[model samples]
Target: MFAQIRWRLLLSYLTVFTSILVIFAAGVRLLFARSLTQQLTDRLTALGQGAATNAEFDNGRLKVESDFIVQQLIHKNQGLEWFNLNQKSILKQGNIGLNLPLSLSKSPIQFSNKNFNIQAVVVPIISNDNGKIIGYIRVSQSLEEVDETLTKLDLILGSSIIIALIFSGFSGVILTRQAMQPIEESFQRLKQFTADASHELRSPLMAIKSNAAVALKYPEKMRKSDVEKFQAIVSAANQMTHLTEDLLLLARSEKKCDRRENSVNLTAILSNLLSLYQPEATAKEIDLKSETGEDMYLLGNAGQLTRLFANLIENALHYTLSGGTVEVTANLVRSYLIVSVQDTGAGIAPEHIKLVFERFWRADESRSYWKGGSGLGLAIAKTIAQNHGGSITLTSQVGVGSCFTVRLPSVKISDNSQD
Candidate 1:
């Protein structure tokens, strides 16, 4: 049981960690990209502004005073161009062409020229003396280098994310294990207490019941009060015995033991269990019957399956009144084996339906103790079903009958296979 809980804890930790990491990584990537783009645009703007200073408008024509120096300033890294106010390119240098953006924008833009995709910025020049608009200077750089750098960054970030996920998964397991230590210890202590209590209590209970039986058998030699006292002791011991046996079973369920892989026939196990309870039903004037369809097969522990059904059937029989009908049925429903133990008894109240499977919980606290109900039967059934990767549910009404359905995983085996 703890093993299952452990894995679930591990997965939950991984899921939360992964979600947080992914969000952080995405934010980092987006911020990094925007920063890089802004840095490139700032560089282009600086160059474009500087180049505009060396330009002038002469005789209604654009001219540059230092063409060679401007070429040297641009170097081989970027393209430079000058455009007239009419949106026509006056001069092209470096890796640029006559093709430019539709307007001169202070911000950088992506544009395609004859040869490359360029990140460029355009700045308009005004004659300082006349305050008239002259021409615009466009400065640009090819995006191949920026693309290469960003690609390398992506690879680094991707590698970091993968490594972090693996580390988190490994560390999460260890951390979750350490965190659950207290719970595990508590369960171990409880199991030990149950084992010790059952072992210690059984001997005295057996002794008391044995002495009571012996005394009651020879009632002629005893007073009426003595006989009554022995009978009470016998009854109390029997109830204690049932409670202890149930505790022992619950403790066994705590261990994560490897289950049997052999196939068990549902039809046979239910049939045998039904036959064993038939006499009790007969004595109560109840009709006990089976509506089993076929001998469905499954891979599981036969003993546990037997006990699981036994608890359900016994509970049904106990709750049902005289002349009630207790029915057992099983069949294959897709991937599950639906086995139901139904009874036409005084059904459970709607409000108490959910509490039926709780350990030691009884709907009617004042009911007779002689009914032999320790209130752990449905709880045991629930544990067994869940441990087997199955489930049990109860449906009841105030005055109508009750039905307890158990769904277990089913399998098929050849006739010659081992039991």
Candidate 2:
């Protein structure tokens, strides 16, 4: 149980942490990539536009206004080239070795050469006097530095994520363990109190019954009032003893040693339960029936499984009115052995149905407690079923009766090694 709790706690924390980290990392990387590309494009576009503006058509020949384009290319590591409308280069700098076709495209275009990976924009040169095309200017910027920076940023994010996960795994497990300490301590205290209280009550209860029995031996010499008093004390002590035993059983149900198991034939068990309750059913004028199959076997502790079914049948017969019907059925369904105890009696209301298996929870929605129940029978049955790797479920309507179904993993004939 603690192992399961620990893993669940760690996984839950890591799920949220990893998701946030992944989203934040991706978001930051995306923003950085966009900003880098935009700044580079903007710088290349401004230089291309300035070069285009410096050209002029002088007496039917295109000519630059000054050495402005050459000055901008020096020491900047940016490629600058001028092209006539005939797609021929006029001025080339920064040792650009490619003779690409002329393009009047405003967007940045990327190309690679031996010296640099370049992003260039082609700005159109228009004659202000005639509003016609004259020539073009191409400005290119090197992307080596930008690529190196982004590569370093990616490596840092990847390394950080790996380290964070490793450290968080260990720390998350330890922190979760510390968080569960209070619950573990409270559970231990509850079990201790139950065991100690039952032990304490049993001793005094035995003494009271022993003294009462001694007094009862002299009933002939005593008045009616004294006999009644002793009888009451003995009866009360017996009741208290039974209650204490039940409490002890509930407390120890989860112990590993108490769950020592063997193959048990549920068919025989159900038959035995039916036979045991037959007389009570007959006296109450109720119809008790069993439709159990033979050799319906399962692996479980015999005593606990017996108690599980016994409690269900007992409750069914207890709440059943005279002339009502109580049925116990056992059958094998696929890999599971199913046992159901159904009664035609006062049923549970919808509001209280979910609380049937809760400890000490009795349904008082429409019924009274005249049919004396300890209210722990179903709770004990539920625990025993779970300990045996089984489950118990219920189906009931308020006016109609309730059915409690238990499913246990069936023992197959192929597993006859236990025989």
TM-score of each: 0.69, 0.64
Flag regions of model 1 displaced more than 4 Å: 60-81, 86-105, 110-118, 128-133, 142-144, 174-186, 205-239, 253-264, 275-290, 296-303, 314-328, 332-375, 382-419
Per-residue lDDT of 97-188 in model 1, one digit per residue for the tens? 53635576656788665665678788877786687779888877887677777788788878988899899888888888898899999988
Best model number under TM-score: 1
Candidate 2 residue pairs in backbone clash: none
Q: Write down the lDDT that model 1 would get.
A: 0.80
Query: What local distance difference test score does each model get?
Result: 0.80, 0.82
So what's the TM-score on candidate 2?
0.64
lDDT accuracy of residue 332 in candidate 1: 91
RMSD of 2: 7.7
